[model samples]
Target: MFPIIFVSLGPGEAELITLKGLKALQNADCIFCPETPARDGRLLSRAADIMLQLDIPADHIYRFSLPMSKQRMDALNAYDQVYAAALSLHHAGKRVAIVAEGDTGFYSSIHYIYEKLQAGGTPVEQIAGIPAFIAAGARGGLHIASQEERLTVIPGITTADEIEQLIQSRSTVVIMKLSQCTDEVHRCIRLHPEYDYHYFENVGTPQEKYICDTRQIEALHFPYFSLIIIRHNSF
Candidate 1:
């Protein structure tokens, strides 16, 4: 059986895919792409978009749905389905590629699929891509860190207390999946007004937006894939 590879499509733009990831997509016999839950009456699949932009043939691609719920059983069910589909394709002698929005291993659905494949003794490979926060930082001309500085990444679903403690630290903080807990995050940030903050939505896509002013954070409607980066002044 051919190996199952997980390819990162980068933040959003087709060109952001790593050279290795590009080559994997080009060489794969079949590609499995995630279909995200609808937002504002629209379903957006960054991996599928990238494949279309790369001119990958429709016949070579397959779509799999992943739930947006926080329940453990729901996540397991989704991963189980994805794993079965990919494994079947792999056993059929097709080199399968699972395309993810950002880096495959970072808070990505592909990670769960990877674990399933690994546990089943399936041969698997991963290609790294630029994560959302890094891409967002570059767009705003924000230096994430320098010598002796620290960087911390927290999921937006984390507790307000944890967010407060992390923000109080000297590390440059990047909060992923900010769409789910905007109110709590906004409250946490308001308490740390001394830090410089930037909110990124749809980083690298045509609809990409950045918020530099802290006041605007409460006013804007954040998308499902948004993130916030905070640079402590002391750092």
Candidate 2:
């Protein structure tokens, strides 16, 4: 059977991809890359750029648009759609790699794909990658968690109340996929004035930006590459 390798491209930088991930990309019979729509309707996501930076052949690269909904039905539907394509490609004896940003299993669409594949008895191998929050902590000059502190990684689409509670807790929190609920996240931050927040968008990339203050974020829309780290003093 052909191997299904799920590769994480890390947070942003092409160099951040693990040596093992690089080898997988180099050997992949076919690669499915995730692409997002830019503000001008252009395509982005930087997988192609990373491949070029590594001098990998682009002949086997394929772009797959990932959906943003969290509904169970929606997730299952999208899974069915993407997995069917993956299944077909796999059956053709293709050693396929689905390149995801950050860790493949951490708050990624790859989980949905994994579930569907497991249900269908399809084999899979998940190759880990450096996560964005870890990169963010490094860029911000702060450790995410020490031995005594709790850590929480929350999706940005989580309810404001849920976020508020997490932020006010003693845990070191990493909030991801904040593009959809940037405003809500900001409001939650505002409510908890004691916490220090850092925002990083596309960390380790040329387009990377860091914001420390919530007021500075006046944009009506959040960048798809954004993540927020909330640190409490008690922790």
Candidate 3:
């Protein structure tokens, strides 16, 4: 099997791609750029965008359309298919690079492929990129965690009771995958008005923004997937 590498292109901005990640992409025999089907049926890849910003050639980049469904088996099967295809490329003596967005170890689809590669005994490496949450924290000048306080990252699918319980700990909570649980988030904010709330959208990109007001967040639906950070004012 051919050796493979996972390159992280941080969040939305092209310049966020790390120096190491860029070099890996430059040296790769070919690249698989992960993309998702947009609402308009167009395949969009943030990795390709970042590569362009870094002056990487688009000629060898192939579209990897990862199925973005909540159905567990569907996505898992898709990952397996990609894994098989990657192995085929490796067999032809190609050193492949799969460009990933965001950090490798944090909720990345690359996790599936990485594990499969491990099982198959292929030489693989990961280039870490800044996670969206971390980038958002830096952009908004918000301290993520300090002293004895803890930081929790949860998906929006979390139950309301679970969310309320988490807030009671007075720790910072970062909410993602918010398309499903926006109402619960608003309710949580209303229930615990003491905590600071900031809504971040398209973090690390030119279109990035944050809202300090709960009312504004409730009134608007972000065009892209967004993150909501709730933290106690202790710091």
| Error in Å for residue 15 of model 2 | 1.0
Q: Write the per-residue lDDT of candidate 3 for residues 99-182, one digit (tens) a residue.
A: 778887787867888888988888888899988888888888987887888788987787657776776777688887777687
Top-scoring candidate (lDDT):
1
- Candidate 2 lowest-lDDT run of ten: 66-75
lDDT of 1 by residue, 87-168 (tens): 9888889889988888999888669889878988999999998999999999999888889788899887776667667766
Considering summed lDDT, which 10 consecutive residues are worst modelled in model 3? 216-225
- What is the descending TM-score order? 3, 1, 2
Instruction: Assess each prediction's global lDDT (C-alpha) against the native.
Output: 0.84, 0.79, 0.80
TM-score of each: 0.92, 0.84, 0.92
**Which sections of candidate 3 miss by over 4 Å?**
222-224
**Residue 132 displacement (Å), model 2:** 1.2
A best-first ranking of the candidates according to their lDDT comes to 1, 3, 2
Predicted candidate 2 versus true structure: per-residue lDDT over 1-235, tens digit per residue: 9668888888888899999999999998888876656668788758777877888777888876655455667556655677888889999988888888789898776677877787788998888989998998899888888887888987777766786677566777788887878778767767776677788888989878888876775443677778888877666
